[model samples]
Target: MRRKVYTKDQILKAAYEVVENEGFSGFTARNIAKKMGISTQPIYLEFKNMSDLKNALLDEICNHLYYDIFPEVRTGDTIIDLGLSYVYFAKEQSNLYNALYVQEYGGGKKMHDFSYNYFHQLIVKHPKYSKLSENKINALHVGTWIVVTGIATLMSSGIIEPTQDEIVHLIDRTINTVLQEDDTSVLDSL
Candidate 1:
């Protein structure tokens, strides 16, 4: 009998599918092998261990978010567009969202940091935020992050099913409230 051979990319693709369909809990070498219709030996041969495979998977997820998910949303407002993209991701890719945010999988920190920094830069460069000081912008970004993440979490968890208008309205209201707050002291504290 001939031994079946799988490349590293092939194994990672199988792992990605497993994670996408089954979330992180179903992310195992055995599952990947099963998905690929091969023995675990091919997976082991392609990677050092599960941890290495996980890191690679994380990179794939991040790339998918950056290239595939985030770029698809364009609302003419960078911050709102970002929020919408995140919400779309949560709604469309519930399993991946839960694995990254809800379950706090191995890639959670990397994803969080990437999202935070990306949104922060958008806020800083936005003309609507130009009148705001650095501290104020930072505060606004934090507030936006909380609101967006909260909405995404709720939707992903099946706690609420808000329409696109409702989601946009909620995000707009939160941003407006942050921008309109008269208490500069609170903004400066951050």
Candidate 2:
């Protein structure tokens, strides 16, 4: 009898399929083996442990997001288009989205940190936002992120199915409300 052989790339690809289809809950040695149509021994041979495999999977997901997904999501409006694209990605890739966003998979770096950094860059690139103070931009980013993430969660979970127009409206309202910031209740009390 000959032993079956599998490459590291093959193993990682299978692991990605498992995570994409079954979410993080399905990210196990057994699932990867089943996806690859092989035994678990090959997985152990290719990687040190599940953590190693998971890190590899996270890298793949990030690559897909940056190179494959985000590129297709672009529209004229950098901010609204990004939000819409995020929502679309969640709907299209629910299981993958859950693994990346819902599950704690980044090891040391968290999903929120990644989002904040991305938003920071987006803010800096915007003509209107370019002159704003860093603190104001950060506040606006938090506000917009909250709304966008909430929408993505709802769409991913099938709790609500909003139209593209609705998503745009929501993002607009959120950004406007946060950026306006006229009322100062804290100072009123003081």
All predictions: root-mean-square deviation over Cα? 2.8, 4.0
Query: On residues 29-107, what C-alpha lDDT tens digit does candidate 1 reach at each position?
Result: 9999999888898888778999989988888878878778875656677778888899879887888788877775646
Where is model 2 more than 4 Å wrong at Cα? Answer: 1-5, 73-75, 104-109, 182-190
Supply the global lDDT for candidate 1: 0.80
Backbone atom clashes (below 3 Å) for every candidate:
0, 0
TM-score (all chains, Cα) for each model: 0.83, 0.82
Cand. 1 TM to true fold: 0.83
Residue 91, model 1: lDDT of: 82
Q: Weakest 10 consecutive residues, lDDT, candidate 1?
A: 181-190
